[model samples]
Target: MKTPSDSQNNWDSLREKIIGLGDHSLRKTYYPELQQKLDDLQQSEERFRATFNQAAVGIALAGLDGRWLQINRKLCDTVGYTEEELKNLTFQDITHPDDLKVSLEWFHRVLAGEIRNYSIEKRYIHKNGSTVWINLTVSLVSESSGNHKYLIAVIEDITERKRTEEALRDAYNELDKRVAERTAELVKTITALQEEVADRITAEQALQAEMRERMRTMEELRRKDQMLMQQSRQAAMGEMIGNIAHQWRQPLNTIGLYIQGLLVPGECGEFSKEHLEAGVNKAMQVIFHMSQTIDDFRNFFRPDKEMTLFRVDEVVAKTVSLVEGSYRCQQIKVEVKTKGEPLINGYPNEYSQVLLNILINARDAFLEKKIADARVELRVFTEKGKAVVTITDNAGGIPAGILDRIFDPYFTTKGPDKGTGVGLYMSKTIIEKNMNGRLTARNTGNGAEFRIEV
Candidate 1:
């Protein structure tokens, strides 16, 4: 029933009496040291009491059975409960149902000596029916003999901390969602770009393939042209042989008649040495003439190895003369006219062949048509600094439909036996391609006229 002031006064009086005893009689004995030790123990006990009641965080003692035996002021404030009210309830009664099981598990493990201590975040139901989040640290206070004892729990209010952590988690989840959406869009863009590139590559490859095909076709056409040109040369050679036969026919018959007369000269009273020598000389002269004819045809048939300067008129006249025998046999007359000595720089042999091809073509046309009084008029002249030659035939004009294609290789209107079709084509090739001149055909007054200009 004593008041606090009376109790403090009595304690001070007892301490002063003990010190007075130690100073008067126990100063030289161990009693003064014993009194000093007792004073220090009292101070320490006071400090422990103050610290336990006024600690920053909640501190409490609980039974191994999860009962709360002691709780501090901080714990009461955290759970909105009085110390006496909390003491009436076990920690399990206030603990959230979701966290109760784990809390009990930790407590039992510590009680069983499986672990030294444990800390956990848990929730408690406050007296006001609000959620109180807390960090709980628990340890067992055991006897020295290691027997199970009460549990000591230290708790800190962490409601604000948990709220901050939840907010951060939500914001992070939103950021992750945006990143996923952006990444998906980027993937779509890249895929579209890839498809476009693939399409362009395919188109380019097709274009290249088409180009290769066209090149191959051009090369094939070139090879065919070369073959046709070669065939035209062979055909020309055959024509030369026929012309030679025509030219030699008359002289060979004359030689036979002369030799036959030599054996019968005595019967005619002409077997004298003078008559024999004169006859021999006449046969010798015929043989010489035949030899010269052979030489002329041979030289005309020889291909020019290189270009030379020559007269257009001369080439035209020479080419006509070479075929004069065949023309005569065919009853085709050829007349040559020269207005000027037109000069040309070209392959003379090829030029002669061109003229011969045209002349022969004219004769064949006349024979095919059976035209009476057929004639070919050839004129050589110079116009506008260009050498020009015109061979006009009286064998009737070419048909308009086939005239344009006359110079195309392997194109002809005559029967296969009469024409190989490359004659005029090769003639054009010689004048235009070989000699860089022009060879053209058109309808003139009498018939088809072939014009060559260089």
Candidate 2:
């Protein structure tokens, strides 16, 4: 390269020769203007050289075949290579192997007149055998005749920016993994809780079904007990009818005998006023006694409508009176021994029925065993704040096998035709269930004893 001052000396020698060939007047006229134009061109070339060498980013020029013709100072520092060293190698030799194919395609497109310039991010191999990330922009330059001359490439280092973006991506992936694990745990816990709730609901349903079945069974038993009570009442009514017949038999015969004797007196011609008056008086007395007997049986059979206060001893005595006639015919004696006038609150008629049942059962035992002197003794007293009545018989006591079951419904030792088993069962029900009392039976030395307490 020639210095500008040397070029000026050469231009002076060439001007002397041209002045010798041309007119002396023409050289005198154009010499000053020519010198001014040469000075201006030199200044322009110096400005371009200063800007290219001092630029902050890397700048380079390469031939169409990728041979580096020139490299700036910044480009030498960026790739850790001197300008002379880069000149010996093509741009393809410094480019990373992974990025070479795409870079060559862009260069070809420019050569084919498809684009004016292209910019891409790519990796370059540094002189120290390390990778350098960079943003590269390349433009095509042509000669004055419009033929391709060389390429001008500008590059910026972007290694730090790329490293920061990679770090952010890794952090986002870790956070997403933690969130997924927590969500799975919550779903599993919720499923377990739902299953436990279902089990509890099933248990409650089973318990409710069992309770309903028990209530239905209790209702059925209640209806059966009521039916048994009605049967016992009917059986007792039949026994009362028999007693009434026994009581009226002797009175009816006496009245018949009196009326017949009066007829005989008329037939013998001795029908006097005094004799007729005496017969009428005797017949009226018998008829009055018979009427009283009917009233006792009628009252005994009437059901009690409500609770009332009554003495246990008085109820026992009245009950014995109702059955006395029948017992007399059967030759069974009843003795009542009362210690106190113990009062209790209950259905009075039902109490009498209970006593009548025990008395009748005693009579049956006596007849069944054929005891010579059958006797039933009842005692009424107050024991431990309760009214109590006990009836004992001397008919060889109830058998050991059947004593415990005597009060059970439909349990009887008598033949079916002679006995309906509901009598004692209903009697126990009246004392215990209806009156809130207790009825118990046990074998005694002479016979069986039944005790009632309220």
Candidate 3:
């Protein structure tokens, strides 16, 4: 058997090996299993830490007092706070005002162990004064001794989903409102359509009646136009007769005076061959002028059967010469400036008559106004590839507000006896209706301008 000393020696050697013998220790000999277990626990802890930091959803370890112990990267991103910043804040501090009561209630339930965990969709106030919606799931963490230690919170960002839901709700409301409005519009449209169907036949009958009335009115207008045209021609004939008389008055008197002078030379013996020749030549010139005047008057009264191309300047000059004596007698300065020898396909004699009537109206205006420095301007030129003529006169511009009515039929400033008033009415109709042309009038500062575009 073993002695006490041997037993003691065995016990000491075992303790020495287990603890330390010569340079060996108990830790090196016997604590390898515990150390390996501790190393394994530390590695697990490190892995958990890395996983928490790299997690997609927010993860937080908070104290029972609601203070944050640790916050992961996702939690920091969720609250727009840095990890260091979140460590100094509490969950209750960041909770939205409206959600604080519910969030606290759920948290207290978890703390009391009444629930294993609590999940609530709650709002948090971000640092920038914006709200963040999150689905927060919280669980209580306990020590091995069953003492509550910390809370583990997982926050899932649901702000975008909440916004989408809100947008869908708003869209539904707008769609409902639009549907109501469209329904009302459809109802009104159907009512209007029913009324239109009910009155369709009556409307057609009324339309036919209106057409007949229009035809009757058109016939009456045509008759009135014909009557006015006849009256206008008669007035023009009367004026032409007056002009002829004015033209012949001085010449006739001159011829008679010359005949009497022939008697003077025979009686006084002062008349020589030269004087007789001069007298005869002068009389022939006067007679020729008178004959030409009659021819001109006849041609002006004549009508054109078809259109012909004619020089605008020739017609204007001829028209001016027709009334030259009258304008000269009235001392009205008449000017004709033709820059481009404009040509037109039109009735020459009728156009000449139109010019004559306008001149006569101007003369009448000057007579009525008694203007000392009366002027009549006629300008013909090519504008926009069309022949344009403007007739302007210094008669104080048609008396202001009445200028628009001047072209109306039977509208005249002259007294009824002095004007037939159909002259300008006919002038406009011939220029616009007979020929493809336009006539417009406007008041200038010192006169009226009549523009004719052909």
Candidate 4:
């Protein structure tokens, strides 16, 4: 119905309208979908950024040349450095010198793809001039085109763990040192104690040897004393009549004096009771003194058959008293001193013989010296739980040449009638072999002293 130009215009306008409508409809539908996709992508990107920045482990990207390309907040905080500062520094610059070679070797392995990921526990220099220990994990990153881009590293701070390890090591070392010192001290103390024990044992051995030697000497003296005692008994028996006559002369003279006094009673026809009593008493005293002399001679040679605890001081005192009258007849003075209770276990008769022997020897020594001031002193004392009896004569000291022979049988320093030489030998035998004691004689300044320890 229209001409050609009109038809062309209408077709063009229709086609343009259709095209506009189609464009409008497509824009209206596809715009929202595209926008949604864009928003999702943006959210994903934000999430990734936040996760990277807030990661607890340090994250970093570095080149094969050890240049740092990117560093996260955690990396900066771990090294005590700003992100900008870390970016400017190479990983090698912060790496400990000692660990540098090892770290490079690990990096080289990662780049060669010999390992998927590499990890190392290493030390790093911090910005504050301190050191940080880290567990480092490194991985190589590559693009789709197979081009190696950078090295990704994750570093976890292990300073606290390292410090704890060091503390334990130090404590162990300290304890070892203390143990060594204690061991040394204990060894020294044990050694000292052992030495002391050894010394004591040696000393005891020496003392025992000395005691054995003394016992041997005492036995030898006992044999000699027995022989001398036998000889002295024979000699005394032959001279008994002379000794009796010598001892009875004074007592007989006293009895004669007492009888004369009784004959002249004072003013009473009957005999005076006082005079009679005095005369009887005087005669009894003389008889008793004579009887004691005979008893001494008899007991000195008597063999004892029993052991008893006898008071040593009392025995010595009795022997001295018995010999007092004889010593007074010779004008010799005797002295005695007793201390504590000198109780000793022995045969009383044998001990009495020992005392008598010593007293006779002392009296003879005094008579031989005949020094104007003749004194014999007998002292008894207790020392360290043992009784010590000492007989000292103020007569001339014994001659050194004869001192050792004094206890030998038949070895006399005086005339046969005056000295039998058996007295000291017998005394030593009784005091030691019989009594389980010690006897020693030494010359003093004035004369000789004999000490008996029981």
Number of backbone-clashing residue pairs for each candidate, in the order shown: 0, 0, 2, 0
What RMSD value applies to candidate 2?
9.7
Q: lDDT per residue, candidate 3, 345-404, as tens digits?
A: 998887887888888988888988899999999999999988888899988877668877
Question: What would the TM-scores of all predictions be?
Answer: 0.53, 0.57, 0.53, 0.52
lDDT assessment of candidate 1: 0.84
Candidate 3 Cα lDDT to native: 0.85
**How much is 73 displaced in model 1, in angstroms?**
56
Every candidate's CA RMSD: 8.8, 9.7, 17.3, 13.8
**What ranges in model 4 sit over 4 Å off?**
1-47, 143-146, 167-208, 218-302, 307-348, 351-414, 424-454
lDDT of each: 0.84, 0.87, 0.85, 0.78
In candidate 1, which residue pairs get closer than 3 Å at backbone N, Cα or C atoms, i.e. clash?
none
- What's the C-alpha lDDT at position 103 in model 3? 88
lDDT, model 3, position 40: 68
Give the per-residue lDDT of model 4 (tens digit) for 1-454. Answer: 2322354477566546545655645745756564455456558757867977999999887877887777889899899999888878899999998999998888888778888798899999999889999999998777778778777889999999999999999999999999999999999999999999999999999999999999998898677666676766565454444445657777889888877878777645767677689789988998898788888667655777788888988888866766676677777788889888888888876676666666677777777777777788889889988888888888877899888888765677779667676666766777787789887888999999888888
